[model samples]
Target: MIAALIALCVFALSGFGLSFWLRQKQDSSQPGEAATRGAEQLSQLRWRDFAKLVLQAMQGRGYRPVIEDGMPADGIPTDGSDILLERGGERALLSCKYGTGSIVSAQSLLGLSKSASLRGAENVIVVTPGKFDDEAERIAVPQHIELIDGSELWPEVRPYVARPQEPTPVPPTAASNIPLMAWGGAAVAGILVWFIVQGLQPDSEATSPALAPPAITAAPPASVPPAAATPATTKPVAPPAATFPSDPAVIEQHRRETANAISTLFGVDRALWSTQSTLMVYLSSEQSDPVNELCPLLERYPELASSRVQLQPPQGSTKAVRFKQCRTY
Candidate 1:
């Protein structure tokens, strides 16, 4: 009983702590807002700070620091430049490009590639907290180099950015009572657990089977022969159900009609039929929730009720894919 009560208390306390932590986190900025704010702050950072940020982001991606003479004790260049990273016995030189609306050029990427080859590095990664030019994309695609743009980089450094601090609205007296309430809740849970544990235990006052006397019974006469055994009955098995065949041409028509209708909605840029059963809708901003907005609009088309819907938010938005068909069932 005592051990169970202790365990219950621990569990209750842990739950309370988790609830409080989650509430605080929810009170902070949303993912979309944080991504926008953090990107702006990242662009304004000094070269040294930007390099450190890239190092931290790379470390989270399973890359470890490769100590060298030019590198400082912080695992980054002393001049606030690039850093060397290694993973699985392979070395990669990482460079950071920071600036608002900055675009990395093909010439810059070509130079970085040559520099990596001279350093005996097997891979190269250029992290620009902005966009990359078309030419740069072509150059990196055919080489042993990887590029991390703003949309991909924001999620990595979001945790490192400090959340905007706000003053507590609760009065001092009310804030002081929170811990007492938590303890009271824990104590109540522990008592309930103890009572349940006690109830499950066997009672000593109940009659024991070994101590009770056996009942006497008389056997039937052997002259009356045993009756004939009855035959066993068997149940019939049911046949398997058939699947419905989906038409590719009809689904394509539904996609086109649905796309035209959804394009008329506010804030929607355009829609495309990526596949026969899949529809991709592009949004003008991250504030749009297609599941709530577009799902209802899509329900008007009965043919598309079974098709999948994918929402593509604007660049740099961390919002995940939203499916329209998920709401049908």
Candidate 2:
């Protein structure tokens, strides 16, 4: 019984040691697991914040980085490239994916490569917190696209990350010259005002009369002798009569003028005049019949008022319209 109890204690100790050793080995193998988890957490940040971090990281690498403006909430942008980085004449196009679970696919890499070419970038980079698919890596390799995983995005690792340099202050002498510049500007303005006043002043030479006003002379009024009133001769005056033109040219001219007036006033599309003084107006389908508007105009011309006026639609197949006779004064 004593030997069996001692053997059981030894077995328990060996089992505990074996478990601890296995745990340590597993932890050692996954050294990057913590960093991967940290990067994944950052993927939950807002898109703007993520982009800002990216900008800072690129700037820290001695690259002049510009975060391209994103689309407004209401806008949909066509370009997928997000950031531009330049250094020593070398240009790089960067596209970022902040999704935690979204995997970068082969098609996305190819699209980024195409965008880089269009933008004249020598290098293309795809930054993502999420892992890429095997096909994505394969395609990116041939296209020379560099993939930046979340593990590589720690901003603290970049030595050059800093704010942009502030502008230099102006010298005291240069600042003092501001008042002198103001005074000089005032003097120039005063000179301009003086010139304007001089120009506006009336010229006495131009206003001067070429000759003196003619002297008024008065002559004695001539006396007239009174004449006896004689009986007025009576002459009969005939009333003026309205005369129609006998010439066909004059009649045609009148017809054209009447047609033009109807077209302009009533928005008629076309007007035709017959030799019998009849007027046919083609009404645009878009406009209502303008007979009420035409009545007042027709009253002014006795001859036109007496002549037959027909309103027809654009298509002759439609019915025609005739207005009642307008009262002539």
For residues 106-186, write the lDDT of model 1, one tens digit per residue: 556645654665676777898876779875675465346798886677788776766632333546675566667666666
Please give the TM-score that candidate 1 achieves against the real structure.
Answer: 0.40
Best by lDDT: 1
Clashing residue pairs in candidate 2 (N, C-alpha, C atoms within 3 angstroms): 60-160, 60-161
The segments of candidate 2 whose C-alpha lies over 4 angstroms from its true place after superposition are 1-31, 66-81, 99-101, 155-329
For candidate 2, what is the lDDT? 0.59
Q: What is the lDDT of residue 125 in candidate 1?
A: 93
The local lDDT score (0 to 100) that residue 166 gets in candidate 2 is 27
* Model 1 score (lDDT): 0.68
Computed on alpha carbons, the lDDT of every model, listed in order, comes to 0.68, 0.59
